[model samples]
Target: MVEFAICLPFVITVTMAGAELANYTTTKMRISQLALLVADNASRIGSGSMNAKTISETQINDLLTGAGLQSGRLNLFQNGRVILASLQPSATENKFVVKWQRCRGMQQVTSSYYTATNTTNLNLPVTGDIDGITVKNHLVTPPSKGAVMFVEISYTYQPLVSLQFLPSINQTINDSAALTVRDNRDYTGGTSGIYNAENATRSLCAQYTAT
Candidate 1:
């Protein structure tokens, strides 16, 4: 009986640890799927004209809302730098860059009013806290006479759970994705202009949002 008692705690601990690890793993996979879904949807919206004076936040919101995600949960980042919370754009030429930010909510919770429950909402405390995530897109703008337009997408992923347990759990997580873009048409001559535009966009949109 003493031997059984000694081993029982160990067994329970190991089982609970495994359960935690599994839950974390499932969350990681769901995040990946979310990233891919957002990126794919954003790319479909295409790049609106940089010179066009009237850009609609409603349209952008509609895009996200249509995808069945809350508009409050989506953030638009341009280049690698600018956080275009609304899809309003300033005049530019040749390249359009953007990323999406999302946050993971609490998986389980305990509160003073109630005990821990599985039916609790799994949304983060803050809405737009995409501290770590992947955002990717490809944009094809109207082919200019001598230059082509391109779209760039980037992502930064921070684990919702602590990094200390990631390796032991066999999960690989990152806080960010390298900036990447795809252009449908090739350009020459005024290529420098396009490159300069892209650089500016990237510089403005490259920070992570924890909230």
Candidate 2:
């Protein structure tokens, strides 16, 4: 029938759109999971080791490496990025500051959704405690003094099915996760006086390798 032929194109377009939407949704969830896993691993850097009281630059690198391993299926290193930030209570009460940061993967990733508190934005208030935050895995506690692993992951998504008829959707996907350090971590870089790791044995930073 003539009408059947006309309707076929619309039907095919709708099916393709649905499939693409599903794939995008799954990709977004994977990104969120990757962020949480990296943050959790970073927060638990010294866990299960009796002598390891403080986190080291090597541990930071290892955490990022673990992130890459977890995202093997996602092909994150080639197409995405992960940023790991250490947040701690500033000298001033009721405030938190990003003590140090490291990143990995090809695509440079920073917390673009929200800027990290730099010198000018040092007065960022500390919200509620770790119990308020929830994810699939139960979170660990922070240092008694207070420290957090803030993670952000960004990935450029390639569509499974391209729809020329539909309005173009931005393929960039991002997610953030925060976890409190369960162990007493050295806020200072031991001898460095700042958060910059004195012994950066490996490079985890993508472009900004300062921390």
Candidate 3:
């Protein structure tokens, strides 16, 4: 009886910790899935005609709503500054980019499953910030050469389970995806020169914003 009493606490603690870890893993997967969805949508919008208006907050908000994600709960950042809580077009023409910052927070599990609470703070985490999406038009001066748009999206994820016991666990996970527009269209001549425009566009899309 004495041995059972001494071991009970240890067993309970281990079991509870395992459950917490599992919950964290599930949340991480969800975040990754959401990030990909956001990136794909943003890229598609940016690929529209150069005459098309920049991606608007209303449009992005509508997309989030359609995806069953609360737009108000998301923090959208562009370039390096946090834009509208949802998304709004800036002065930059023919560009639409989005970055997924810290979307999930540490998990808090209680003794009872029914009472457990999981908190997700949309703000950036201390470890680091995730990269945002970059959408740009790949056009050059020569009218004969058609233009194409490109998008690059990146994400930084941290594991909720601490590394104290599980040394094999990775502290962070980083993932990125890139897509180029299929439409071949030419852009109007502008003050911006067209030398190596496509490469420059890709470079801009590759820019990383601090979380």
TM-score list, all predictions = 0.36, 0.72, 0.38
RMSD of each: 15.5, 6.0, 15.0
* Candidate with the larger lDDT of 1 and 2: 2
Model 1, 65-115: lDDT tens per residue? 343342123222211111212111113443321122222222111111111
Q: Candidate 3, TM-score vs. the true structure?
A: 0.38
Clashes of each: 21, 0, 3
Clashing pairs in 3: 57-87, 98-133, 99-132
lDDT of 1: 0.30
**Alpha carbon deviation, residue 73, candidate 1 (Å):** 13
All candidates in order of TM-score, best leading = 2, 3, 1
Q: Which run of 10 residues does model 1 get worst, by summed lDDT?
A: 78-87
Itemize residue pairs with steric clashes in candidate 2.
Answer: none
Candidate with the greatest lDDT versus the true structure: 2
Ranking by lDDT: 2, 3, 1
Candidate 3, residues 1-211: lDDT per residue as tens digits? 9999999989976876686577547645654555455545544543345653233334434443333342222222221111111121222443322212112112221111011122132221111221223324322111123221211122222334454434565534333323332233222222111123233221121223322
